[model samples]
Every structure is written in structure tokens, then in C-alpha cells.
Target chain A: MNGVHDLGGSDGHGPINPEPNEPVFHAEWEKRVFGMFLPVAACGYFNLDEFRHAIERMGAPSYLNTSYYEHWLHAFETLLVEKGALSAAELAARQQQIAEEAR
Target chain B: MASSAHTRPLSEVEIRVKALESLLVEKGLIDLAAVDALIDKYEHKVGPRNGARVVARAWVDPAYKARLLSHGTEAIAELGYTGMQGEDMVVVENTPEVHNVLVCTLCSCYPWPTLGLPPVWYKSAPYRSRVVIDPRGVLQEFGLQLPESTEVRVWDSTSEVRYMVLPERPPGTEHLSEDELAALVTRDAMIGVTKVSA
Candidate 1:
């Protein structure tokens, strides 16, 4: 079997190359949401001060479990529902409308 | 940091914010240069030095390394840097025998507290898939050549948690102080592609 590095190239095996300096929508959102939700998430779940202390303690990970965009989507969805900005039913309805519109 | 108020997807709030940005560009409520300046300011001021300090400390102190492995964030705060992106972190250590590497396989889960923003490569799918399977080869591309006997461990970062690598300290630095040790801790070392050198 080919190693992981061998997977991205023109033959549809390797990873596709993105344009240099391209602005990524997902990453932009991830950075925004990370900055926004981290404080609240830390305070409500883990101890706020302790949480900050822990983060400065390590280096980068080998892999991320979810896409950066997913984190933004997750945080946004959670906060929207929590703050009554959008009800679960409304979200479901909007998703259905979008899906139907696509069809 | 702003409150978690704009989390919803495709909502009116986000649209309004975008619209406002556009309007500011059109009507000059805010200059584009000023906005760019603000972004740069935060990116630099709140970036990953805190995490780098932790990695540097672990390199110099064995006991601190033990503490970092057990309780990463708390261990880091012992050095007096706290708040923001560092609320949650996990420490993965590398040794001469077993090298630890980091990749954001899914998207770009990074230890923002220490490292600041994830580099563009970390967020790319190619780096994510390639690193986990052929870490030695990837390291080679990054100008790192490891022995075959060195085992590679790849950690996957998630939304709830982040990770950082504690690279082994290089030789010829026994006489160096902690501040000197910190200088040797390059961003690549913390990512596990390179080791600290004299």
C-alpha cells in the first residue's frame, strides 16, 4: 500500500494543491469562533482560569478530530440554540428548505 | 475576546455583520487598513508564545515535563501565562527512541494557547493524511531525517481538546539557562519535525 504522503498528486491519489495564499472560509470561521466561544466554554464547563493555564502548556497535535469549519459550525449551532437566536425546529426547517431548494 | 454570540450558521446576525463590514468599506465607517491592523495586532499579540514557553520549560526541566504530561494546562500556568486560547491543552512528549508528531487530520485543531494560529500547512488535507502514515518521510521533506528505529506517534486534536509536543532537548546545552533553552525551541520542534539543537 502507498504511504499517506503518496496520496496527493495529479493522479487523483495525492492531496490536491490549493492556490498559495488562498483565503480559506472554514479556517477564518474557526479562528473567529475559537476566539469567541473559548472563554464561555471554559467558564461553563472547565474552570476558566485553569483552562487557560492548561492550554499554554503544550504543542500542536498530530491530527485534528474535526475540520476547523466543523468547530465553527458546532459552536455556532450550540450557541444559537442556547441563546434562543434560533430554535431547533427553525434550524431543522431551514436545513430542509435549503436541501429542497438544492433539489 | 468577543462573546459567543455569532455561532449560528447563515443566520441574520452573521449576515448583518458581513454586511456591516461591507458597508464600512463602502461608507468608510471603518477603514480597511484599520481592520487589517486590528487583525494583525491580535494575531501577533495573542499568538502562541505562551505554548512555546511551556515546550521550552519541558525541555529544561524533567520534573516539569512530568507535570506537563500529567496536567498540561496547569503545568503551563505555573510559568504565569494564562487566559484565552489556553483554557484546554494536552501535552505529548517526544523522546530519542520514540518521536511524537502533530497533525490536524480533520481540519486544524491546534494548541492555540502555546502555538498561536495553526500554520496554513497544518490545516491542509495533504499534511493531515500524509503525516500520520509516513511521518519519517514527511519529516525528511521538512529537512528532518530520523532513524528507522525511531517510532512515530501521531495525536489527533479534537474540538474539546488541543495538543502540543514536548520535544527532547538537544545536546551541548547543559550549561544553558532556561531562557537560552527557550530560544532553541523553534516552532518546528514543538510540531515534532525537528529537535532543539545547540
Candidate 2:
């Protein structure tokens, strides 16, 4: 899948800004998203290729705008729904519940 | 109850993740405890320190160096850094005349078992897009100015195979122990963005 994620030779993004003393994860949410990979993987819902493909399938703007772990989160949601492990409606309902709880 | 100092509203993505996690747990599709253990493994048990040990060992032992370059996955596993993204590895050696750097042009396919998770800059669009076309320029931006004569080799990692740079040992550290050598090896050095100093 040729997408913005395949950013090999294309240019004009900007100067690389390597942060000083960067942590492994920037946010707790990012950590949760990172941790989700192995266990979700253990369920055998989708393989690594499918996982990467799901991320690649993101629209160019969304893919580029989102953070690194957001990409992982996107893949998890996309694959789970696509694989019948979870339905989109259920995920949406859960999201609503969580958003309400947070508020 | 008032929100504590540490408490804040979760980001939209965070809310989404929390929602997904809880639902997955409810459906018995994933284990929360297993997720915590995985986080612990990445946060503490595994990291670039593992790769530093490998680089330090190779610096001290020529035999190990040969093994690492030729049979990367096995040599690395001998040191007990094997699994996941590091299952198939290629350890590229940097030398006086040649410098090696790695990037996953397609995606962030790094040797996680060795170097742990990649830094943010590694996954950013700028580094990924520019490094392959203008290696010398990118290296220069990293403050690693090579001689005009030094060849810059840029390795683009794939899903199956990953690359790590075996940075050349710096001079004037003959008395340094292997542990000391490991301490000098930084994540960026292993990533080939910078050189390990004595």
C-alpha cells in the first residue's frame, strides 16, 4: 500500500527535532496503546502485516496528523472491527461511555 | 471530590483507548494484567541497554563481533535479546571510511528487543522522508559531520528484517572495562545518529 506512511524519499516535512532526554512514552495513554499490541496480538485476531496495513489504510491527513501511538490505537480499532473480534458500534458505545465518565 | 494534581482530562485518543481496552476485557478478548506485564517488560526489562551490552561485548571480543555481523539474530539471542521485532536482525558495522544509519521508510519497524521502542524523531515524517535521499545532510543535522570521503550507507528497515549499527569503538579507552564500554554506548549511537564517546 503506497501511502504517506511510506515516507522514504519524499521531502519537505521539516527538520528533525530530536527531543532532549525523551521518555519512552510521552503520555500514559500512549503507554496503554503500546501495551495493547502484544495481548491483542495474542488473541490471534490479526497478524503483524494486517496490523501495519490497517495503519496504512488511514487517510493521509489523519495518518500524518496523529501521534505515533495514535497510529497503533487506530490499527487496533480498525483490525478488531474488520476481524469480527469487536464491532464498530460496540466500540463507539464504549467510547461514548468513556467520554462521559471522563467528563 | 476535587481532581488531584496528577489528574487531568484524558485526551480524545486516550478516551478511545480506555474505551477499547475495557470493552476488549469485557469481551474476554484481551487481558489487562497481561498488558501491564508487557508494559513492564518494555519499560524496564528490555531497552537499548541490551543493545549497549551487545555493542560493548562486540567491541571487546573479536569473535563475538564476527558472530554478531554474520548471524545477528543468533548472536544477539546468545546475549538473551531475542523476540518480536528483533527476530531477524542485521548488525551493520560502522568504520572509519563508512558510516551506517537505519530508518524504516515504510513504517517504524525497529529492532525492539535490542533497542527497545524507537524515539519520537525516528518515527516522525521528516527523518523518514529525508534520510534516504540525503544521508549526509541528515547525518550533518544530527551533528555527525563525516569527511567528504566517508561513505554514508542508509539502511531502510523492512517488516521482516531490522538493522542496528555497530558503532566503531572510540579511541583512548584501552583500560575501559566491558561494563564501562556499555555505559558509554548511547541509544543514538546504536541508532547511528551519533558516535559513542569515551
Best by TM-score: 2
**lDDT digits (tens) for residues B89-113 of candidate 2:** 9999999998999999988989999
Lowest summed lDDT window (length 10), candidate 2 chain B: B1-10
For each candidate, what's the DockQ? 0.09, 0.74
Tens digits of per-residue lDDT, candidate 1, B1-198, equal 223475334543344234323432453334555555445545666455566678777867789989999998899779775564567878888887888888765445676657766666676666776776777777876778988888888776655677778888787888888887777786777877677777
lDDT of 1 at B136: 74
> Which candidate leads the pack in DockQ?
2
**What would the per-residue lDDT of candidate 2 be over residues A1-103, giving only the tens digit for each residue?**
6787889999789999899988888888888889889888989998889988898999899988989899899999989998898899999998888777766
- TM-score of every prediction relative to native: 0.59, 0.97
Stretches of candidate 2 exceeding 4 Å from the true structure: B1-6
What C-alpha lDDT, on a 0 to 100 scale, does residue B133 get in candidate 2? 95
Candidate 2 clashes: the total is: 0
